[model samples]
Target: RVSMACCLNMCGAVHCSDIAILGYHRKPPMLDHEYMDKMCEIPLAIAACPTAAIKPAKITLPDGKEVKSVSVNEPRCM
Candidate 1:
């Protein structure tokens, strides 16, 4: 028989045990471009990513508002 626990305490059992269950919650951040310019600091967000998934990008809206945005590489995001 095998026993497992949720990884809330960062215990090392997951690595050495014969069968251990490890789970983590990972949800990529949603980008709200309409309010992004006023609310977020692009450079800080990019730097905060541990996996280097956030990237700087630009978009031109139909209303002709040129806004600075970010692109997230979902595959690399964790």
Candidate 2:
């Protein structure tokens, strides 16, 4: 059986393969806006990103009020 892992954790058993074609980023992080708000401080995430890919943003909810959030520059994310 072939196994692959995105990172060094090697949980998928890539170490077992002499010629493992390990996959990369096949599963991106879940960054849903609702969860982001609850999970982290947006300002800190923005500041910590060295590439300045994250910026302040205002998102309008279903109720039509704007809320503070972060915006990402996809190209700079690399």
Candidate 3:
């Protein structure tokens, strides 16, 4: 069984389906983008999202490459 700490700490890898068993937001919030690459795992989050509100967004990376990232529709989430 994956712990919520694992999910929150590695949320970039955990998703909606995983949430069904793993729980949500296990750890305290992190404002840093150090592991942004883990955002690639958002599809799992989307799958786990009961509200179906999670969506994808195009983000311009620091290196000037455009890529997809998980974005919550609300301004607070952005």
- Candidate with top TM-score is 1
- In model 1, what lDDT does residue 13 have? 50
Q: Which should have the higher TM-score, number 2 or number 3?
A: 2
Top-scoring candidate (lDDT) = 1
Find the 10 residues in a row with the least total lDDT in model 1: 3-12
RMSD of each: 9.5, 7.2, 6.9
Model 3, runs deviating above 4 Å: 5-35, 75-78
- Model 2: ten consecutive residues of lowest lDDT: 22-31
TM-score of structure candidate 2: 0.55
Give the runs in model 1 whose Cα sits over 4 Å from its true position: 1-26
Task: State candidate 3's TM-score.
Answer: 0.45
lDDT of 1 by residue, 1-78 (tens): 344543333243565677777665467657788777689788976776667787988978779988998888989866
Report the C-alpha lDDT of model 2 over 1-78, residue by residue, as the tens digit.
666654444545688876565555434344566556777788877766656767888887777867777887767663
TM of each candidate vs. truth: 0.61, 0.55, 0.45
Clashes of each: 0, 0, 6
Q: Write the per-residue lDDT of candidate 3 for residues 1-78, one digit (tens) a residue.
A: 332423433444444344534445533334223345565476775665545556666677687877666666543231
Task: Point out the higher-scoring one by lDDT: 1 or 2.
Answer: 1
Model 2 misplaced regions, further than 4 Å: 1-30
